[model samples]
Target chain A: MKRGVFKRSLDSLESIFLFTSEFVRENHVDPSLLPAIDLIVEELFTNMVEHSSASTADVPMEMSTVDGGVEVTLTDEDADPFDITKVPEVDVERAVEELDPGGLGLHLVRKFADSVEYHYQFSNRQARIVFRKTAGSGGDDV
Target chain B: MFDLERREAGEVVLKGRFDAAQREKAQALFDEIHESVTLDCSELDYISSAGLGVLLKTQKRLLAEGGRLKLIGVNSHLRDVFKYSGFDRIFEIEPG
Candidate 1:
């Protein structure tokens, strides 16, 4: 497993992408999986940076290879109990005139990732979100 | 490494990764358009929901004015993103 920490800012996305790219390269993960991995990570990481409040600590990320895919975990320290898995589904069928962008990021996360799990630690006020993307999994078109 | 350029013919070209960090730059460019336009994404490598939001906002605005955003040169990976998000139905997309 490889681990890194990024500051709680939008600019950290570039660094996070670099970290993800390096990890995937070193691990020899399927090239076809890069898009899903990138999208899922970006959505989840940006969600934390944008929504998590009262936290100055950096977010920790871990990446590792699983059976036929990669697994990533991001922990937001000093954050409230915001269960991402329970977020309401987005009404994607809304017409263009009524379409709202809210919750779309997490909606994409759920769609692209093979599995998404969320856990919160009350004592430390930590929100840990882990997602896995496997080759030939999730989005049929992908 | 994201770039957006508006051509003389009014087509906007997009390149590189369009994540949350590039949203403002993309929005600024989209704000300049008032008519139906085609976004040439031939060189675009990736787009997250943030980028999608920018396109969605622009599409909504243009649709309100009886105009729409047409996307062309989308790669397979991006096609999946659009397909899963139901954006394929929202916009006219031409696969690269």
Candidate 2:
């Protein structure tokens, strides 16, 4: 497959994760791992949808499901230079402590993914996160 | 939005996603239950760290009111979230 392509407004984050989750479950990625995957995808997708700049804001998120695992690559040509890796650690106690309602998405991605890579080249930003079903190969089974 | 209802037996069952979008309402709805409440998590499809925070907050709120909170129909996914966050031990969980 050429991988699934998702292109929509910033408001589509919830549906994006919901749709991707079905694809993950269909791939036999393990029913046990769905929550972690779901959370990570929700967090990541929400970030890409909401945080990206308005100029190239119409960017599309591409997802590929291969033999080994699922790979989500969020691509935005006109997005700002900030890296999703910058999403800080949250004190879970104060996750919503009126402090701020942002940055938790990247934390979820790191916490759940086996490997998270952010590649910014030629003013094009792509955050590719890979989650492996089998543990110890660099990813947690969760 | 989740539609909530009360019982004469002093129990409350929440039906729907207990996620970020619903946490605020869930809290307000939870506050009205003046007695022990058992949340039916079967209809709850997903929850996030924010939602989990709401649960913890509710637990503290209920305990302070001399009331208890229990969760029912917790699937593996939700259970994982609870376990990962250590809320599994915090909530009075009952298997479906």
Candidate 3:
């Protein structure tokens, strides 16, 4: 598994994207799947930055090649326990005027990723989210 | 500071990435415009949720005043983002 650490600031978003892009390219991940992975990373990273109450949010991430897919784990230290996988999905049929921006980030993460799991460690006061996506698994929408 | 690149046809062409860093500038750009506008995003490669929120707010304001905010030249990558966020149903997306 390849690992990296990112600061919990909005500016760190670009670094995450750049690192993931290079990682995907080096690992031979399918080019078509990059966008799905990109969106997932952004949403999760930003969620941690905006919602977490931790004074030092060091986002530690790992990426590895699995059987017919890629596995990813994102960890963050926060004062409160948060489970992003539990966020309820929003109704897509809502009128444009009624569509609020909240919750769309996690909603998209669940929609595009093949598998998502969340875990919180009370001892360490940290939250971890894992995801796995296989080539051609997300969708042909992109 | 975010650069506002406008075209002669009243289309705002967004280039490169639009992230949280550009949120304030983008909001200011939207605040000054009140007419119907089409955002040309053919050159846009990436947009974060903050940027999406700006677009959503602008669309909401435009819709309230009977004006329209359309998106044209959205590539499949960005289209997927819109589709997942349910913005595809809200905005008129012209084929690239």
Q: What DockQ results do all the predictions give, each relative to the true complex?
A: 0.72, 0.24, 0.58
Tens-place lDDT digits, model 1, residues B7-60: 867588999999999999988978988999899999999999888999999999
- Evaluate residue B10 in candidate 3 and report its C-alpha lDDT on the 0 to 100 scale: 60
Give the C-alpha miss distance for residue A33 in model 2, angstroms.
Answer: 4.3
The candidates, ranked best first by TM-score, are: 1, 3, 2
Task: State how far residue A46 of model 3 sits from its true place (Å).
Answer: 0.7
Give the poorly placed runs of model 2, Cα more than 4 Å off: A1-14, A25-33, A48-56, A76-108, A121-142, B1-8, B21-28, B64-68
Lowest lDDT 10-mer window, candidate 3 chain A? A133-142
lDDT of 2 by residue, A24-68 (tens): 667666445556666766666555555664644444555556555
Is 2 or 3 the stronger prediction by TM-score? 3
Model 1 residue A113 distance off true place after TM-score fit, in angstroms: 0.6
DockQ: the better of candidates 2 and 3: 3
Task: Report, to 2 decimal places, the DockQ of model 3.
Answer: 0.58
Model 1 chain B: weakest 10-residue lDDT segment is: B1-10
Please give, for residues A1-142, the per-residue lDDT of candidate 1 as tens digits: 9999999988998999899889889999886788789899889888888887578889999999998889999999999888999999998887877887788889988988989999999998988999999887875353
Measured against the true structure, the TM-scores of the candidates, in listed sequence, are 0.97, 0.67, 0.92
Q: Can you write out model 3's per-residue Cα lDDT over A1-142, one digit (the tens) per residue? A: 7898999887887788778888888988876777678778888888888888455768899999877667889898854787776778888779987888788778877878899999999997878889987776654343
True lDDT of residue B13, candidate 2? 60
